[model samples]
Target: MINYISDHLKNNPLLVLDGAMATELEKHDIDTDSELWSAIALINNPEAIKEVHESYFKAGAKVATTNTYQANVEKFQQFGLNEAEAKKLIIKAVQLAQAAKAEFKADDLLVAGSIGPYGAYLADGSEYRGDYDLTITEFMDFHRQRMQLLNQANVDLFAFETQPNFEETKALAKLLKTEFPQKTAWMSFSIKDSQTLCDGTPLNEAVKYFNDDQQIAAIGVNCTKLENIEDTIVNIKKVTNKPIVVYPNNGDIYDPKTKTWQANPKTSSFKELVPKWIDAGASLIGGCCRTTPADIKEIAEFT
Candidate 1:
C-alpha cells in the first residue's frame, strides 16, 4: 500500500490530501467542543465525518485522513470511556474513513490514520510549544497502543503529525522502525518559524535526524503559518532526499482559550500559494486549520 501511494505520487504532479475534518464537521452543525475534538463526532455523528470525507473526495482529494487525531485512550478516559471502549472508538474512526473512501468510489484514494501529538491530548496549546516534560519512553508508551490499533484497522499508512519537538519526532521514528517496521508513515512538524520547530529546534537539524530512516517515508510541516511554509519546505529539502509533505493553516491564529480561529485579513490566496509550494518541491499539498472543500477544489483545479 505504501509503495502504491509512492508510485502514485511519482506519477502525479501532486497528490491532493483532504482538508480539515473538524472544521468541515463544524459546517454540519455537529458539536465538536469536547476534549476529543473530531473524535467526538465518531460516536455521535459518524455519518457526518464520512460526509466530510466524501466532500473532500469530490473536491479531488486522493487522501482522506481518519478522524483519530485525538482518539487516544487518555482523551477517551476523560470522557468516561474505559480502555476497551476507547479502542473501539479508535478503530471506528478508521472504519468511518474507509467507508467514506468506498462510498466516494475513488479507487486510487488512500487513508492516512492520524497520530497527533501528546500535547493534543493535554489540550492546553502545548502541542504548539512542545514544552511538556514527558520522557521518550512515556511518549512511546502513549503512542504505541494507538499506532497498533490504527495499523490493525487497515489504514494505508500513519500520519504522525503536528510533532512540535525534536525529541518526540525522534521517538516516533524509533517507535515506527522498532515496532512496526513494515508500516510506512509521514512525520510532519509544527513550526514556530520558517527555520525552527515549535520547540525552537532548527528544522534542518530535525530533518537530518530522520532523513535516513526508511520507515519515515516523508518529512515536512503542517499546522503552521502560510508565510512560513515555503522556507520550511526548502529547509527540509536541503537535508533529505525524501518526499516533502506540506499542509499549512489558512494564515489564521488559533485561540485555544476561545477555541476559535481569528482570520488573518492578509491570508495568502490558496490558488496563488499552492503552485509556490509545488515549485518548492512539495510532493503532497493540502490544508490544515480553517481550510475547506472549496479551498481544496481550487487547489485541485490549479494542480
Candidate 2:
C-alpha cells in the first residue's frame, strides 16, 4: 500500500495533499483552539471532520490527513478518557479519514495519519520553537502506541509532520524503522528559516540525517513561511534524493501569547507560489495553517 502511493508520486508530476484540516473544520463551526485542536472535533463532531475530508477531495486533494494530530493518550486522559478509550479515539481518527476516502470513491486518494509534534500537545506554540526536553527513548515511548494504533487502523501512510528538531525526527524515524518497517512515512520539519529547522538545525544537516533512511519515503517542509519554502526545498534537494513534500502556512505570523495568527500584508498568493514550489522540485504540494479548499482548488487547476 505504501508503494502504491509512492508509485503514483513516481509516475505523476505532482500529488496534491489536502489543505489544513483544522482550518477547514472551522468553516463547519468546529472549535479548533483547544489543546487537541481538530482532534477535539473528532470526539464532539466527527461528521464535520468527515465533511472537511470530503470537501478537500472535491477540491482535488489526492490525500486526506487524519485528525489525529493531537489525539494521543496523554491529551485524552486530560479530557477524562482512560488509556483504552484514548486508543479508540486515536484509531477513530484514522477511521474517520478512511470513511471519507470511501465516500469520495477516488482510487488515487490516500489517507495519511497525522503525527504532530510533542509541543503541539503542550499547546504553547513550542512546536515552532523546539523547546521540549525528552530523550530519544522517551520520545519513542510517547509516539509508539499511537503509531501502532494508526498503523493497525490501516492508513495508507504516516505523515510525521511539523517536527521542530532533529532529535524527535530521528526518534520517530527509528521507531518506524524498528517497529513498523513495512509502513512508509514522510517527515516534514517546521523551519525557522530557509536554511534551518525551528530548533536551528541546519536544513541540509537534518535532511542528510534522514537521506538514506528506508522508512522515510519523502522529506521536506510544512507550516513554514511562504517565502522560505522554495529556498528550504532547494536546500533539502541538495542533501537527499527522496521525493519532497511541502505544505506551507498562509503567510501569517503565529503569536504564541494569544495563540492567534497575525495576517501578513505581504503574504504571497497560493496561486503565485504553487508554480515556484513545483519548480523547486516538490513532488507533493498542499497548505498548512489558514489555508482553505479554495487555495487547494487553485493548486489543482494550476498543476
Candidate 3:
C-alpha cells in the first residue's frame, strides 16, 4: 500500500488530509513530565488512540499521522530520557499506531509517521538555524535514527511538520533525501503574524529552500490561526506549483484564563473551511491543535 501511494504521488498528486492532534488522548493520563509526555498519553491506553484513528478514518481522512510527534530525544529529555531511550520510545510509538491502523483494517488509509522538528525551537529561536548550534551533519545524524524506525514500520509517508525556522528545514531536506528518500515527505511550516515562519524567516524563502529538495512531496502550513491560512497558501503558491496542504489550529487562541482553546474558530465552520482551503489551492486539509474528529469529518465530506 505504501508503494502504491508512493507511485500515486509520483504520478498524480492528490489532496492529503492529516490526522488531528490527539488532545483528547491526553485526557487518559496526567503525567505532564513523563517521557511519553502529554502527546503519548494514548500509548498506554490503546483504545483511546484507536478510537481517534477510527474517527478520522470515518471522517474521510486518507492519511492518518502516527501519534509520535513529540516522542523524540529533545522532548523526552524534558522527562529525563537520553537519546537512545528516546529513539526506542519513538519506535514504540510507531508500533502502537500500526496496531491501531490494523484493528480498523485501514489498508487503504495512509499512515504518515509524524516527525517534528528536532528541538522545540530552531537554534537561534528564530527561523530554523542550522548553524546556530550544530551543522547540517549533526541534524542528519539526529534524524537518521528516527527515520530508520519510520521506514521500517512501512508507514505510508513521512511528514516533516511544524517547522518554524528555515535552516532547520534545510537540514531536514538534506537528511530526507539522503536517508528516507523512499518515503514521501510532506513539510509544513508554523507561522506567526503577517511576517514569517515562527522564527521570523519569510515563508517564501522557506518554500524556495524546500523546493530544491525533490524529496518533499507536498508543502504548506499548519498550527496557526484560520484567519492566516488563506494568505499563507496564496504566498506559498507564488513560490512553487507543488501540491499545498493546510491544517490550521482551531480559531481560538488558548485563553490561559480559562485553560481552554477559544470555542469559536473564526475562519469558518469545519465544513466551510474545507472548501476555502480547496479554493485557495490547498490540495491537503486537516486540523491541528484544538481540532477533533468532527472537524476532520467535515473535511472528508468535501474531499
Candidate 1 C-alpha lDDT tens digits along 224-272: 8888888888888888988899998888888867778887898887898
Candidate 1, residue 23: lDDT:
90
- Model 2, residue 106: distance off in Å is 1.8
Query: Which candidate, 1 or 3, would have the higher TM-score against the true structure?
Result: 1
Clashing pairs in 2: none
Clashes of 1: 0
Q: List the residue pairs that clash in candidate 1.
A: none
The TM-score values for the models, in the order shown, are: 0.96, 0.96, 0.83
TM-score between candidate 1 and the true structure: 0.96
Write candidate 3's Cα lDDT for 139-175 as tens digits.
7777776778777767778877877757777787887
* Best model per lDDT: 2
Question: Which regions of candidate 2 fall more than 4 Å away from where they truly are?
Answer: none
